[model samples]
Target: MPTQAHINMPAEPVRQTGMLRPALTVFVGLSIVTGLLYPGVVTGIARTLFPHQAAGSLIVQNGRTIGSELIGQPFSDPKYFWGRLSATAPMPYYGAASVGSNLGPANPALTDAAKARIDALRAADPDNQAPVPVDLVTASGSGLDPQISPAAARYQAARVARVRGLPVERVESLIAANTEAPALGVLGEPGVNVLKLNLALDAAK
Candidate 1:
């Protein structure tokens, strides 16, 4: 009451309101555009342009899905060409379990596995005098490799031919035909798709 000091203090500037509204609006807009719109457009384009690959590159026979060209299947029969060793667990070539053996060169487990595979191959083809191809005994990095080096295919050609009662020349020719050239003519080494080659063998019968 003592003249409340007639001292007047300037009122604080009105605090800025609604500054967050624009920021929130921008965040929502970008989320919708990038997360939803961008992916939808790209997927649609892929579906339209590369239908087969977009659909998983499936291989169908007689109205039934046999397998995918992109994934490997286990073929232990002597009459079929075998693919690389798969490290997938519980089941060979199980897509859900795609992985490498993760064994190093010095790992005894790897050495033993290679020896066992070599023994098995030798047992299967008692007459195959050619040195076994490395791919035949080694598991690929992904463990789901559908293809094998052409040399690996040839290593088993004689055995497959003998078992199927087909001429070695014919089996070799099939292998040649199934061999895929390096991508863009230089990206990768020649490889043969085991599943395709096996199916071709069946078809030739």
Candidate 2:
């Protein structure tokens, strides 16, 4: 019988070691670039180019931070314009806990909620005969919308005017002045920033 030939085989440990080194190097490199460098660069650019937005678009008054233009504040007083209903909890317009009510259109809970809102509005301004705007009763998708439809704002104009003892025309004028046109003239319907409108109303007083 012929003598058997011997062959060498690479160990499994050696192959694994070869693969692990490059993978670790790649992971470290990518982590530094994406996790550190990329965010730093983007934040720097945002601070430089859009400082107000980068700073949360805060609105200051009397040397104090009152609110942010990007977020809605709860204004239940009849003298102020109301923004969209917030579903956030444990309070409305709670930015850190922003969320929707998640009730579908056909859900009975949603219908009941709408009915309650309508009843509240009717109770608040029993003399006003105009129909309540739907947006006034519905919580927005994000539940933190700081703006309301122009129609919604106008619907409450008479109530605000009566509550503040201001003329209806003056309140309507404020609404007109605060109303923002659609972006690029066609992208969105007109809306009024409730915070700004309420601030203007205060300033007017």
Top TM-score hit: 2
Model 1 per-residue lDDT at 90: 94
**lDDT (tens digit, per residue) of candidate 2 on 7-62:** 88869999999999999999999999999999999999999999999999999998
lDDT of 2: 0.91
Clash totals in order = 0, 0
**Weakest lDDT window of 10 consecutive positions for candidate 2:** 76-85
Displacement of the residue 103 alpha carbon in candidate 1, Å = 0.7
Tell me which residue pairs clash in candidate 1.
Answer: none
- The parts of candidate 2 lying over 4 Å away from their true place are 1-9
Query: Which regions of candidate 1 deviate over 4 angstroms?
Result: 2-19
